[model samples]
Target: MAKLAESNNLVGRVGNAGDTAVGATAGIRLRKSLPWCAAAILGLVGVVYRAILIAVDVPPANSDEGTAGLAALHIGEGRDWPTFFYGQDYMGTFYSYLAAPLVQVFGTHWWTLRLPALVMYAVFLLLVFRLTRTLYSSWFAVFVTAVLAFGSDRVVKDQIIGAGGYSDVATAVAGLMLASALLVLRPEKPRTMLVVWGGLAGYIVWTHWLALPYVAAAVLLVAWVGRAGMTLRRVSLAVCGFLLGAAPLIVFNLRPGRPDSFSVLLSLSGATEPAAWSDRLHGAVLVGLPLSSGLCAPSHCATWQLWWGPTYLVLLVAATAVAVAAFRRADGGGRRVHAGRLALVAGAAMTLAAYVASSSSAMTPVESARYLHYGLVSLPAVLWPLWVGAASVVGKVGSGTSGDHGGIRRRVTGPSLGGAFLAAGCIALAGAFVVGLSVATGQLIAHRSDYAAQADDEQRLVDGLRTAGVSHVYSGYWTCNRLAYRSREQVRCAVLDEDLSPGLDRYRPYRDQVRGSARVAYVLPSSGTMSVNFARSTPALGVDVVSRYELGGYDVYLCRQRPERG
Candidate 1:
């Protein structure tokens, strides 16, 4: 009996010692992780601050940015919620609505409009960290966050002077993060998680109609994963939650005067015909590649040719491999699935869908970096798992014996090989980072002159128009939108092939009413249109060019039209 007690005590002591060692090791790891987390947080803050500085006081460069800024200005002015310059419905009013308070407080300042987007982007980075940490380890989470912090081109564009506050990128990031969280949380408590999943879905739809299908796929994935053992109550809860969250948006969408909203949703869902393959390919290369490259670059149009470098491709391949491995090992059983993996899958799907949907007959093989902004959130998610896998492999190989080897012998033998592999992987990743960064820097430097020239010309044109007693005007291409936003003038029309139709249509009635109304002061012709059309259209209406400026391969024509005095 005494011997038996002694033996049991010995066992207990050994177990306690093991537990103590483990706890100590975990404590050390946690301590080491703290600095990295702090660094990431600080980095995120710096990025946001930088973005605010760059965007503040800068005029909107793109039509989308100009339109969104205008909408926010309208909201600030206490105009109707959805109505902008021409009573046209703005598809993405969520960001505009969020920007309202800021607009109200700041009164149409660039920083005021841009601040909300900056904050949302910061939230997105933090969420990426949290979600990555929850699904993986701190190391992996930090790596993922770092990639996101630097890997997105849109961040630079939106942050930079004149890039305009592209809120859609922020919206897509937030929506993807929310969807990832819901998927990760769903497996633990089906009933509670269903509400989250449904709510996120609705929010995505409201945020950007483009993100809805991705959100839907995420929800369906959760349902499919949990279908077999899920309780009826849990299923019902999910459905109810989804309906509850989606009800408001649905009602708003169905409201009598929301044809634009309805059409946007349909277009995103492939109800509309796919864009031409050439056009899609062109967008993919021109916008997608450059933007992707910019994520690693220091500025815009940097090293335009190498925006999508080999490093991104390598990391993507590695990530895909790790994801496939992890997914294959994941059982339907109780072990909590990693949310990062699920997010990666969902993100890839969303990106693919966006690419396919955005393609048109005019799409070229080279796509635009801008259009692929939807996939920005997904890229890091996909990269995280591969990094984790590489680290794990290193740790394993360094431990010496393949399995069950004597501890001392294994320690001495394992670490060398493991360390080498780990070092190599890190070095490789670093090289890729350098390449991307270099390319981005080059692109930015190359485009600096062009951008500066354009800015100067744009300011001159706006000044001239405002000086000429032109309170409202119609122009086509980039300058029109820029002037409207910067000069706060009502743009009667824009001539562009892109989807500025909504903004342009606002001026149609004015154009038609020209015969009956006062004479117009200014008319701008688009470079995209033939000069013959301008000559025929302008003289017939008694319009003559008063001033012209050329910059960045674009010409701006300022015209004055004879007004009809009553």
Candidate 2:
């Protein structure tokens, strides 16, 4: 009986040990997956957020977005393989290419056209989460992700819009940051990684000129971190990678009759109008930063969300100060963390300096804020100090020195002041995010009513044109592409300038088609330059207006013949 009891006890002990090992392994796996799960959830949230914005037309579809959508439509039909935006040589057609398949499959509604931006934003969120986690902790990653999942009104607009390369540039910048971070931490990184970094840099060069600052910062980061291991072979490999990624830009420029995109970019980068350095600096610091940070609305900075603006500025300044202090005393792996943080700071500084010097800074803060969009990629690093300090303070408070009340008191007193400051900064940052989200949500709601009215007007216009059998017409720049795309080519319109002259038509075929029509119509806004020009020009051009219909804000004149300016 004693031997049997011993056997049963040993078996029970073995079973308990096995159960403990299984639980530990499961716990380890869960820990490993938690960050990714958070990332995936946050990414999904970001997509849904942007998708809702796109559906409601928070930005209201403009000519630029229409052009992008048209490009996708053309790509779907194999009408053209464009390397750059139709009228803008500096902005790549990558967004259109990405949207082509979606447009082809789903047709060209705003959602289908803007779906690529959603995917790009998801990628941006994932990369940002990974980058933050790598530099700091998983908790920091979640914080950053949550903040970005619902960005400020301006950030939401930039991310959700399909017009320009804003979303694409943001994603590329995040990728550059992650690649730079990896290289900084692992000096012995394989050559392939260098190639990838170079490729991303090259891609950014073509994606948008606004991203140049990020590309430069990323290159400098890797150069400094891998300076010891960098060799001619590695450099050559990077250059080759750059060439591979930039092949489209290079080939397009090298082709005859193509405008030099580089020159275009240069001209764009130069001053739009001369302004004093002080004014530019004032605009960048006072207006641009707040708009970029989402502390205030664009152009309405001083008036809207006034309280959060100053609070955020103070938090930003405090965080930066703490980061500098931490960097000075950091050691070991902490040194690497600070190095990464410094690189981000340097990038942001360079961006600010560039903005201050550029005439773009003199524009409305909202207009100029687009130039600062990529700087948001550095935000995680900028806010890292606050998070780290708060975490350290919590740890110190929780740590017990049993029977040493004096020691505990001393520990608390020593870090308490700084810890409180850090904690306050963090709390303010969280508040800023909440304020930003509220502003975005509020703006979206406000835009919904306007969007519905605009959409209804557009539909009425389309219906009138179809009912009148108007297959070809002349319209202003803002209406031409939008009308054509929305009508699904049922009523094609050639673009006319404000003066009723030949305007910048993106697709020449549309113009030719309109001009060749035996009878055409004129679609002009009731109060714009195009209306005045048409009313004055048609009489002298000997074009007879047989009939006129007022459709929404537009005047649709059925003309006996196509009007031409002599």
Candidate 3:
């Protein structure tokens, strides 16, 4: 009996030894993977820091940003979801939902309202790392994260806006990453993956309806690429998952007073053909290239600006060449896919399609630019592979292996290709970092005076109106949205013919009612067309000019008046 017990103990010891060895191996693998992990952490930190700087310096002052911020503020104020702001039924309940907790904890500070966007952006970076790692190599994952961290002009601008926060960028990026991760990781058991992907897709649609087409295209692409021998059961699961995830948002959208833009597009029956070739080509160059060029310049220009000189052109061409090469060289068929190439193609195709569809009749350059931004997130993928390839060449040269072409080839063959890819990735990432820093510094230096003046003028207007005992104000173009957001007074404004006019129209009927009731205590005119019209048109009501201030090329006028009751 004693001998039998000893034998059992020996067997137990052997099993324990095997388990420890497996665990030790896993630990070693994890340690070796720390570099990629560190990159992700650093990328997140960079996003957070950038968000903080933008929040501190810019404030939530722009009309779009302020509009969203105000809605968020209302939610923070314990208002229920889907509350009306102005006359429009503001259904941006998700952003408000996110802001509610922050407001509860931090009050209605601009930064607090902006925190959701900041958090979403950081989350986006983390998702990028995870998705890229799953689809590609660890090195490529780090490379992708770094590029997104530093390369995107829209991302930087959205971060700076401090209001729209990161709604559009965050939703699109996160949705794509999540969808891609599920597709790559669980290609076989697509039921679970489809549910996750569909939920994210629905959330993205809710966040930015404009991006629905892009999202749909991406979903279709994933379904096609990662088909994994789909059965009827799998197809049914996918369909059900998509419907389940999307139904809630779709129902909400279909309700009375909900936004209907997405529905309108769908009902149009996809009959809208592509735009003219000339228009698409022009957009590809002007919208894609020049807009990106402005990121390298001091001022962020949305159109063809003279600021982008020969150097900008050269860099643009070089980047384009690199992107083309990467796309062409990318292995379309293999066990390991080139996700970067797929993303680039998908993004470019979507952008081109959008341009063709919209620009067929009217040459609205700005609209084209805006629509193209949906696909612009894929730019990093296109550029990343080229940068990685270049870095590999540089590494080979540096290591004196360039002379031994056969040795270099052997080193880059098979699994070692991932390592060579990393060599290139590091260099490209460093370059992107330097460019981002340069652009950021340049913007700060060039715009310092303008931003400071705008800030001072904004504060002055707020203080001046309060001092003058003004309440129930009607703002002209200059103080239209600004005063409405900043002042405690109930503000009104005419629908100005401008970029944000569509949004402003949401309040038009209310403004008309206030005008009819003669409830306005003050009128503030901006030194622009709408303000000038207000000043000239409302003269019979006796304008008592309280103060005038200038900000960013617009003159502001604060006036006290009793509206002539009819």
Candidate 4:
């Protein structure tokens, strides 16, 4: 009886041990999957938020967006094919091509125009998560993803607005970073990564040259890490990939009569006649930083206080410092972190320098922050140091020993003190992000209604033009392409310069069609240059305003123009 009882107890013990083992395995699986689950949730939340904003028309449609939409419309109808944004030798038509099929299916609505940007943002978030996880810890990846999921209003607009190539630039930069990371981490076989990195680099060059600095940094990092893996054949494949990806740009530039995109890019960069470095640096540090950091009010950020600029500078400096320190003593994963972080810092620095030297910075520094938007791609690297420091401190504290000297001492060790400081820094970052979200929420609520109303007024103007039987007209830069897009070519408008003459005229065919018309109307805003130019310049150009009417904030004047002397 005693032997049987002992055997029963042993069986029960074995069963209990087996159950514990199963539970431990399950826990390990859960831990491994949790970060991925959180990342997906964050990405979904971001996409939904952007979708809601688009539905509400948060940023409102503009001429740039309208031009992109019009390109899509033309491509959809097989009317005309463009390699680049109409009237520009840069900013490839990839976005329009993406939207082409959608325009055909959905019939050129605002949502159809914006859906590509939404998709790009979703992909960008996923890339960001994957890249961060590869370079740092899962915990850091989740944190970075969360930071970007609900960014400030400026960041939101940069990500979601379908204005040609801005969102595409972000996605391309993330892709480049990821490919670079993979090449470094898996250098034994780097052919695929080399091709991917090259393709992304070529695509970004064609998509938006503003991201060139990032491409340069990515290329350098890949070369650094994959030095051993690179061979003549593999490198040739990468070259072929770049040639293939950049075929459109190469073909366009090669065609006779096409303006050199490189020249156009350089002219735009203020490189021809450089600004004073002092002023450029000041603008970059004060206005550009604040604008990109989402700390300044829109449209009038120049006049705001400079408090927001330092916050970004501090964060960047701290992260760069940590990266430099890590590189000096790196081994294994630390080397990868150092390389990734250094590349990001180099890219961001180059972007800032490019902006500072650009004519846009010299002219309208605050307003031209759109150029600096590419810096958003480097955010994961920027936060890596803080993440590592926190983890290191916590680990040291958790593994430390307590000692007694004389009486039992109640004191924190060096690791504990460091942990306290890291915790405080983390709290500050959280607080900053919370404040940014609050401001963004308030701005969205306040401005969404205003933009919707503006869109309505625009529609009213379009309706008035159609009712008046005005198919071809001339308007300011901001109103022309928008009118064309919203009217779906039922009404065509060409851009007029500040002097109310033929200007930019993105699609030359539109201008030609309008100029060929003997009868044209002047659609001028109630205020600003439209008002001043009409009252001052139109009469001088043999433009006779016969009849006039008002449509919301616009004034439409039906006019007849006499032929000009050659």
Indicate which candidate wins on lDDT: 4
Q: Is candidate 2 or candidate 4 better by lDDT?
A: 4
Model 1 Cα lDDT, one tens digit per residue, 1-566: 99999999999999999999999999988876784677478557547544734453332356555556666666778865652223333243656767777767765445566666666666666665665554444555566565555533344555432222234444454554555454544455445656665665655555455555466556655656555645787767766766765565566666786665656445544426657665554445444545554533333343544434444445566665655665565444212243345555566556654655554313432323444455556655545534543545445422211111122122222336666676577656655654665455445545556655655666676666566555555555444545566665443444332322223433344344332334343333335543435555555646677765543344445665555433
Across 133-213, the per-residue lDDT of candidate 4 in tens digits comes to 766557668878877777455666677777768888889999988888777766765476677778888998888988999
lDDT of all predictions, in order shown?
0.52, 0.75, 0.52, 0.76
Candidates 1 and 4 compared by TM-score, better number: 4
Looking at model 4, the pairs that clash are: none
Deviation (Å) of 243 in candidate 1:
4.5
Off by over 4 Å in 2: 1-22, 188-190, 270-272, 276-283, 295-328, 389-415, 527-529, 540-542, 562-566
lDDT of 2 by residue, 365-415 (tens): 567777777877877766664565555545433221111122221134345
Model 4 misplaced regions, further than 4 Å: 1-11, 188-190, 274-276, 302-305, 388-426, 562-566
Tens digits of per-residue lDDT for model 3, 431-488: 6544654564456545656666776766676666566554445544435555655552
Q: Which candidate number maximizes TM-score? A: 4
Residue 172, candidate 1: Cα error in Å is: 5.7
lDDT of 4: 0.76
- Model 3: what TM-score? 0.71
Better of 1 and 4 by lDDT: 4
Worst 10 residues of 3 by lDDT: 399-408
Model 2 weakest 10-residue run by lDDT: 401-410
